[model samples]
Target: MKEELIVKAYEVAKERYAAIGMDTDKAMDALQKVQLSLHCWQADDVTGFESAGELTGGIQATGNYPGKARNIEELRQDVLKAASYIPGNHRLNLHEIYGDFGGQFVDRDQVEPKHFESWMQWAAEHNMKLDFNSTSFSHPKSGSLSLSNPDKSIRDFWIEHTKRCRAIAEEMGKRQGDPCIMNLWIHDGSKDITVNRMKYREILKNSLDEIFATEYKNMKDCVESKVFGIGLESYTVGSSDFYTAYGASHNKIVTLDTGHFHPTESVADKLSSLLLFIPEVMLHVSRPVRWDSDHVTIMNDDTLDLCKEIVRCDALDRVHIGLDYFDASINRIGAYVIGSRATQKCMLQALLEPLDTLRKYEANDQGFERLALLEEAKSLPWNAVWDMFCLKNNVPVGEEFIAEVEKYEAEVTSKRN
Candidate 1:
């Protein structure tokens, strides 16, 4: 969009929001401060740089979209291209399998900070921070379980892998001068009924205790729980209850992946409860149609409510937001831009809300007035402010980013074959 039109529209939007006791400038500033952690797997459909093994562990990435990144350079280039279209500075979330190992096979347990030295240097060059995750699936030993697995030798391997990942995350944080959110998720469950539920959880708890025994000041440990996976339909060893209880008791950050819950469950409602106990929370923002499909996030009601809750609770700095989805059905870069922008839009909408007025009405027992004002706030000039934000950030405003993605695909990704 033209700069003149954006400026005019923003002026009008600023006045409109001012009438509702909202400050557009403050909202824009808050939006700029939110540094979303973009997932690296989105560029390559979770097919990491490790072996060409089939994706196991109850996870799968559908669609055969072309131009998937084949190596570290291509992946980083694709991510950089996607980041250019986004507004603010962001962090890159990396899985253990995506390390730059120089064509050498560094198994999970044998991996170290040296395997990721090139990545750290690359991130430094790009002025981007890094986050880390332990890859517990798509391996030979992943069939049974990792941390929760009863077999000591198999479990020990994964435990070692997670420890190394934490160490790597600590080093990343130390290098970047910010805490690296190291998230740990495992597809550890049974396809059928599991008889020894207590035993499995106990073993998993012990494993986590050992993994987190050596504390690092630079990295924050977050434990993620899943409802189920593709093959593990009957029971998930690390259910929501287990992780919530563990996180609260152990004072560790708990990760809430929107797709990792039941269809009818409200992820937003748990935010307040978790904030009261845990020091911090990590959010894996995604869209789940009816299950844990890991679809690209959109500016839907679910996402809106999540953002609203975060703003309402005044926990913006406490809750770390990150994208966690891989959809190969469309242009990979397009998916990244769309998901990240949608999330930012949600945050903008939340920031533009007349929260003070609404809360005052509620406190005064004026339910009808509060509901009426909220309904009226829905059609406010949020888009104008969003456009202004993009304009200020020097990115393509509105749907202009679509053309940029198409151009990239034609000139860059399409020739990958």
Candidate 2:
């Protein structure tokens, strides 16, 4: 059904472009790009990064589904229905969806408190979570604050941001059941300096300590690495940095996005090493389109294979998986399809992997199974198996069986040593 819709949309786009005397090749290329994005398994199909007015403009511009949604309520309903169609275990990026809900990166003074509250409520009701890399937080003091002589006002600004986050969490808790689960990304270092780099590091740490101590005392902190630049782009806050932070602070862990590391970095080894440091980690699952972190592209087989290894190692229980994307062009339905397919493909890879049997043996703490359910567990549809794991283990997806996996790894490492 989705494929048919995509095909029809492509044909209509082609005809419109031809009628306008536009370049057929460019139109076909755009159509193919949209189709590819739609078909991609790891993409999070999301829409509505605009207000009711902007959405009206988008509807006219795209001549797409947004035309059907006349009002804000209608758009909200459309987003909810789109979320429902997406897989339960799939990780969703909230940037596009919640932009209209009042979580924009505008100046602190301009933020409408009521709009922010409405946004938090919407997220809770949808059961969707937000994850940020480094672009998550914005501050007016960013341009003014120097790491060498950090201003008191800069510190105060960060503190206020933290307080606002906590207030939002509390609001969400009041409306929903849990506090706001936010991913903190701080770009607190300078790129031009080399002599006083250590000072910058200390300042960044102190700032984060203050932020975490006050606002995120109870929230999960996923420390992600930014490797876009040559080297040492920011503070030491990747998996290794997370170890120190987790050792020092409570309710903290690493959120590992697969693309953040150097291409040469061994992902399997990285995952195993992180397990030794922190008991849990969150995952942002996306394929790199041109060496980018959050491309809403299809998951390749190699990525699926690695995900399989992680599952075979029983790391899913420790990692919360989310579909992380920031592209505004793709529709919400497309995002859902991509995320669902990525998750499904990854699960299928895990089940079919030869290592799965051995991993199961290690996970169950005993020999292989004989029951029909046990036999079917290997081939039971990915969604069904994940649901059972959620129910049987009493933990949400990506958090089930993490302790056991870490324990097994410890034992294995101990014996090897």
Candidates in order, TM-scores: namely 0.99, 0.58
* Candidate 2 residue spans exceeding 4 A from truth: 1-78, 89-114, 120-140, 144-149, 178-180, 191-193, 215-218, 229-251, 328-332, 352-356, 359-417
- Give the Å shift of residue 53 in candidate 2: 17
Candidate 2: lDDT of 240?
Answer: 40
Best by lDDT: 1
Each prediction's Cα lDDT score?
A: 0.94, 0.44
Can you write out model 2's per-residue Cα lDDT over 1-417, one digit (the tens) per residue? 533444455455445434433333432222122111111112222233333322210011222322233334544554454443333322223332233443344544233335445555555666554332222222235442322225766656555554454444444445544333455544344335456545645665665666566543334455554443323243332234533464336546666566666666655556676667676766655555545555553657546656665665666556556555544354434444455445545654354333534446567865544243345534433433333323332332332234433453344322322
Q: Which model scores highest in TM-score?
A: 1
Tens-place lDDT digits, model 1, residues 7-74? 99999999999999999999999999999999999999999999887799999998899999988889
Clashing pairs in 1: none
Which run of 10 residues does model 1 get worst, by summed lDDT? 288-297
- The TM-score obtained by model 1 is 0.99
lDDT of 1: 0.94
